[model samples]
Target chain A: MRRIKCTVQYDGTWYAGYQVQPNSKTIQGEIEKVLEKIHGKPIRISASGRTDAGVHAIGQVFHFDTDTKFPVEKWLPIFNSQLPNDIVVNHVEEVAGSFHSRFGSIEKEYQYKVYRGPHKSPFLIHHAYHVPHSLSVQKMEEASRYLLGTHDFTSFCSAKTEVEDKVRTIFTISMEEEENMLTFSLVGNGFLYNMVRIIIGVLIEVGQGKRAPIEVKEILEAKDRRAGGKTAPAQGLYLYRVKYSNDN
Target chain B: MRRIKCTVQYDGTWYAGYQVQPNSKTIQGEIEKVLEKIHGKPIRISASGRTDAGVHAIGQVFHFDTDTKFPVEKWLPIFNSQLPNDIVVNHVEEVAGSFHSRFGSIEKEYQYKVYRGPHKSPFLIHHAYHVPHSLSVQKMEEASRYLLGTHDFTSFCSAKTEVEDKVRTIFTISMEEEENMLTFSLVGNGFLYNMVRIIIGVLIEVGQGKRAPIEVKEILEAKDRRAGGKTAPAQGLYLYRVKYSNDN
Candidate 1:
C-alpha cells in the first residue's frame, strides 16, 4: 500500500472533462483504465480539481495508491505509452499515505489565452480564443484589482453551480500582452465552477471599453451571476499549476 | 471573369496533400469544392507549389478565375464559412489575368522547426519535430553554406521524383535558435521534390556530429539521391512565403 503522485498535462480538446462519466471519454477515465490493466484490479485515482470540457492543463496533479512492484521511474513512460497522445503523464513519485491531491492543495494558477487579430490562424485554432478586435491590457488590469483578496465570488460563478459556499481568495491576477496575443494568469486558493471563465468575460468587456474598470467592484458586491458578463469559451482556459504545502 | 488570388493557410494534419487526388481529401480539392458550390460549376485552382501530406503552410498562394458576382472582400468570409476548420483563406484579391500562381512565382521561403528537448509536448505534437538530444546550430549553419547559390540538387531530392531538371538557386539557409527550439529557414528560386526536407535531414546529421560540414559539398556535387541523408518528416516543414514578379 504505497501512494504515488503524478504531474499530468493534457490537450483537453477531445475530453468530456477531467471526471469520469458514462459513455464519454475523460482524462481521469483514461488514466484509470491504464492503471486497471497494470494493477489487474479496479483502481481509483483523485485529481487536484476538475476542468470543463475543451479546457487544457499543464501541471495538473493526481494521486493513487497501488501495491504493484513497478519502480517510480517506470510509471511515466508506462502511463504515456498506454495513454492517448492528447493526454500525457509527466512525472511520477512516491508520496505520503495521508496526502490528498485536492484537499491538501494550498493554491492554484490558471491562464486564459486570447489571440487578438483580424485573421484567425489555423494552427492556433485549438489552443487559443480568437478575438478579432484589439484589446486594452491596461483596462483589463485595472478591473482585475477588484478581484483580489477573499470575497464571495457569486457573480463570477456559474448559475447552475451546486456548491453552497462561494467565498475564495484570489492572490493575484496579472495580464501579459505580446503583439496580438494576451494571456491572463490568476492565482487563487480555490475557484468556483466556471469562475475563471466568467471573470475573463468581465475583463474582456473592460478591455473592449464596454464596461468601466470601477464597475468590477459593483459586480462583485452584487453577488449575482447576472451582474457579470457572459462566460468565455472553455477552450481559452488552462489549469497552469497546482501548489501544495509541501511543494512535492 | 475575375482572376481571384488568395493566400491560404492550413493545418494539413487531415489532408492527403495540397493537390487534388482521386478519392482523397486535399486542400485544393476542398477549395475547388467551395468554388463549385458558389459558381454551380467545377473550378480548377493553381497553387504556387504543392506541399506533401502533413505539411503546414502560412502563406501559400493560389489563383482561380471565377465569374461569380461576389466582391473581393466577401470571398474571404464566404470561402471560410464553406471550408473546413483546418483550412482558411486569409487574403483575397482580384489579380491580373496573366498572373499565374505557379509559373509567375519568383521565390519561395520555407521553414523547418525543431524542438530539442527531453520531453515531448502534446501541444507541439502536430507542429514541431522533437529531437531529444543536443544539437550544434553553428555546425548546421556551416554545413548550410555549402548548399547556397546555384547548384544541381539531385542528391537532395526524393528517389521517386520525376522532375527532369535538378538545377535550382538557393538564396539563403539560416538557422535561428530560441531556447530549445531551432528553426531552419531556406529561401530559393525553386525546389526539387522533397528537396527541403532532405536537406534538413543532412543538416540535422551535421548538427548531431554524425557528419562533417564539408560533406554537404561532396553530396551536392554527387548529383545522386543516395548521396544525401534521409528525408525529414513533413509535419515540421512549413511554406512560409512566396514572392511573385509583380505585387499582384
Candidate 2:
C-alpha cells in the first residue's frame, strides 16, 4: 500500500470544522467520502490539524493509505472533479508509509486578516474581520514582539484546550498592512487550540489603546486564559501553510 | 419633497437581480423594504441601471423622493443599519427635485475580473471568473482598443435587449494585472444590456488565440448578435461607478 500525501485548500465558510461528526458537514468527512467512492471501500485520512468553522486554509495537509492502482497523476483531476467547489486538492504525491500527517509536522504558519475599512465591504464580509474603529498597526507590531520566542502560551490558548503542555516555540510574528487590510502572520513549531486567535485579540486591544504594548509580557506571565482578551472571530483566520522536515 | 441620491454597493450572489420582481428577492426590493419601514409608507426608488443576477456593484446609484423630515446625516447610518449585510449604503445627499437617477447619468464604469490561477481558489468563487487556461493579456488589450470610442453595439448586447437605439460611446478600456487576477475596466457614456460582458467574452477569445485582435472590428461591423461570441458570466462583472454631470 502507498501512503499518498495531499495538500488542500478550503473556504471553510460552510464546514462544521474539519473533523467528522455524526451529522454535521465537515472537510475531512467530504474528502473521505470522495476517497471511498474512488477506492470502492472505506478509507480514513489523517490531517495535520483541525480548523474551526468559518476558518480558511491555504495549505492544509493530509495523507491516506490506499492500495488502488490508480495512476498518481490522475488523482489530482479526479479528486478535484468530485470534491466540492469550496475544497480543492492542490498537490498530491506518493510518500513513505511511515509519514504521519499530524505527528510528523515540524512547523505551521497562520495568518489573520483584519479589514480596517471605515465601512464593511460586502466582498470581505465572510473572508475578513471588519474593525471599523481605527487601529495603530505600529502599536500592534510592538505588542507582537513580546510573543516571539519560546514561552508557555497558556494565556494565549482556549480554556477548553485539553493539552497538558502549553509550552510552544514561536519562531516569528509579523504584521503587514496593505489596502486597508491588516494581516498578521505567525510561525511556530506547533499551536494549541485557539492560540493564534487569542493572541490576535490581545494585540488588537493594544492597537486600539485599550492595553499597553508591554502588557503582553504581563499577560504571558499570568499564564491564565482569563488574561487573554476576547478571541478574534474565526472568519479572519487562515491556516497559511504547514512545514514538515525534508520538505515533505 | 427631497430627492435623496445614494451610492450603494452590493454582493449579488444571493439576489435574483437589481430590479424588483414578483415573488423574487432583489436589491431594489430589499432597499425599498428598508425605506418603507423608515417612511411609514411604501416608497419607490429609481436606479441608474439594472444588473443581472450574480453581478456585483461597488458604486450603484439610486434616488428616492421622500417627505420625511429625517436628517440627511442620519440617513447613511440608518439605511446601512437596516439593509442586509450584503448591501452597504456608502453616501447620501439631497438632490434637486428634477434630478433623475436613470436619465441624468452621464458616464458609467464597469470592471470584469478573471482569475488566472491554475486551480480554483475557494476565496474567489463568487467574486471572479476562473479561467484556468493561460490568457494573453496583451492580445486582450489589443482587441479592446478596437472597441474604443463610439459604435453601434448591437452585436455586443444581449439579444433580449428591448432598446431600439443600440448606439453608445465607449470612452476607454484599460487592462490591469495584479497577482493572478486580470481586471478589465471599461468607461462609457452608457452601455447596452450585456455589452460589457459580451465584449469581455470576445476579448478573452482573442487572448486565447481563438480569434485575432482586428476581428473585433468586423464583429462590430456585423451588427448582429451572432457575431458576438458569448456573454461572460455575470459574477465577474461589477458596476464600479456611475457619474453624473456636475457631480450631483
What TM-score, to 2 decimals, does candidate 2 have?
A: 0.99
Q: Model 2: clashing residue pairs? A: none
**By DockQ, who's the top model here?**
2
Residue B61 lDDT, candidate 1, scale 0-100: 97
Q: What tens digits encode model 2's per-residue C-alpha lDDT throughout A220-241?
A: 9999999889999999999999
- What is the two-chain DockQ of model 2? 0.85
Every model's TM-score? 0.97, 0.99
Segments in model 2 whose C-alpha atoms lie over 4 Å from true places: none
| lDDT values for all models | 0.92, 0.94
Q: Tens-digit lDDT track for model 2 on B1-248?
A: 99999999999999999999999999999999999998899999999999999999999999999999988888999888999999999899999988888999999999999999999988888889999897998998889888888899999999999999999999999989999999999999999999999999999999999999999999999999999898999989999999999695
Interface RMSD of 1: 1.1
